[model samples]
Target: MSAGEQHGGRVTIRQVAVHAGVSEAAVSYALNGRPGVSEQTRARVLAAARELGWAPNIAARSLGTARANAVGMVLVRPPRVMVVDSFFTQMLSGVEAELNRAEVALVLHLVDAFEQTIDVYRRWYAGRAVDGVILTDLRHDDPRPAALRDIGLPGALIGGGPDDFDLCGLSSVDADVAGTARGILGYLRALRHRDVARVAGPADLLHTAQRDAAYAAAADDLGDLRYRVVHTNYSAADGMRATRELLSTAGPPTALVFDNDVMAAAALRVAHEMGLAVPADFSVVAWDDSDLCQITVPEITAMVQTPALQAELTARALLRALAGGEPTHVVLPAGTLTARGSTRPPKRLG
Candidate 1:
């Protein structure tokens, strides 16, 4: 049998170096297309590697001049959210689709806090476990970008606009929040519903802040409009509680908008429990479309942001950054509000 066959078909760089009659470091430099090796040495290394059917082990290659050939993403959310929210699943599908095409692996982690998330990044960087990272749920004056920059790690931000992190050198992808908020509020106003309240996600989140500002501006632009916002953790329980409180108030909003479909579904349950007629009593709108919206009683009006497309764009931006391309921000079209049985003129007007 040949010497190569004796190694059980797993040829190491050391073996290639020995076969090429060169130092292991020289073989590594040559194989990885680094600057230290001459063309003759590189040719010899390539010939030796090919003859032995040798392939670079990703972990070992990462220790040398070669890239890790993988990217990381951390979700700082309760584990339950991971299972209940289809948004992450849809977004991951898009990211996976892009990474699969590029032959790169995705290292995903779930953590409960930002501090833990940061620790993960530090550990990943120290171990050379990833080429770069993807960031989500950007917060006001977020320290994550700075942390990544300090560690010299390349990154991309999902769910942020062109105006975010201008100096930190992160590529970002975002939908047109200002336009989406305007569209949703305008539809309600057109239906003669002047008192509208928003069930928003965490106040510190950049996108939620953006939505708040946009909604406020839109409400101001429409004279005689009364707008209010309540913050939540984007959970079904919070949605039901907030919905119950708002509907219980003596002069509550004539319409309500939720940050996600799960919350909107909760709002529907709240309406039923309170004996309030959807659309006839008050209207409901959800941020993202889902099966829950359609299956719920009095199907909810919702905004479709096309999460898969958004995620694909974000993944492409990260890939470009990893390839030493200039970082750029990409903005997708705004969410399209789909009117359903859940919205109409207020009872007084109807």
Candidate 2:
């Protein structure tokens, strides 16, 4: 309802117009900073509105302002995994905080299947469920960008721009995923570990692809050094199994890098079960340094990736999209090395 026809709130724009002795359109124009009304009339209308204690209802504002007053994020990952994943958990908290400051709401949903994710995105746009959306966990040749464009929905990507993903016409807040890998490998190399391996997340993810490429390049840089990448989900169980297999191999790596803390902790536990001493028999490193990294016998060394910062910037990008801001890119720096008990100079056993 406009000021004239109001419900829910105590004061209506009709009351303000009556007090100002002006037509409702004139009052609305003055109050909204539109050009139709003179400065004196605008001031009078504003005063009248203030005196009436009238506030725009968000529900009514949404209808008139072409805004849903909420942003959407549809996660392909399940809630069970999301709770344990420090990256998502911390990132969401930052996103929520930023959105709160803007007085916009968040509509977050998790899908049990990948197919449902596309449907949710389409429905959210077709039904005006959100003003804009934040896309994450992007994959190779992802179709969501194209789908979003087709439906006239606005979105901001969590990864890089056109170079990193399809992107289409969206802006992005990119993380230094490859740089993080380089930092991890560089640290291990400095510790005199010639053989290092990575237990990474799913291969299809764009970030994982970037990290994998970096790992390969780093291996090439260290002449005669051995490196291998084992793909796994960001799960403790997968981490444990991968660690067991890597350790069982002959002339296994002297150091290991995991995509996340959960996997690193799993690696640490497996190393213990195999009667191998951490930082001696094997050194461990994780991409995101979280609380899980410190709980182990030898606190895991990790890279200080700021997932919260990434999420904050990503949220801002979505806000820009909602405001019809031009598409652009923002690249964030990679995580720095955080040396801990789980890393040391290479120690070899016969």
The best candidate by lDDT is 1
> What number of clashing residue pairs does each candidate have, in the order they appear?
0, 2
Instruction: List the RMSD of every prediction in angstroms.
Output: 5.7, 5.5
What overall lDDT, based on C-alpha atoms, would model 1 receive against the true structure? 0.85
Kindly report which residue stretches of model 2 are placed more than 4 angstroms away from their true locations once superposed.
1-12, 16-63, 77-83, 161-164
Candidate 2 on 197-237: residue-level lDDT in tens?
88999887877887887789877876767899899978888
Q: Where is the poorest 10-residue window by lDDT in model 1?
A: 57-66
lDDT of 1 by residue, 104-154 (tens): 789999888777878899999998899899888888878888889998889
Candidate 1 ranges beyond 4 A from true positions:
1-5, 8-64, 79-82, 161-167
> What lDDT score belongs to each candidate, Candidate 1 first?
0.85, 0.80
* lDDT for 242 (candidate 2): 90
Clashing pairs in 1: none
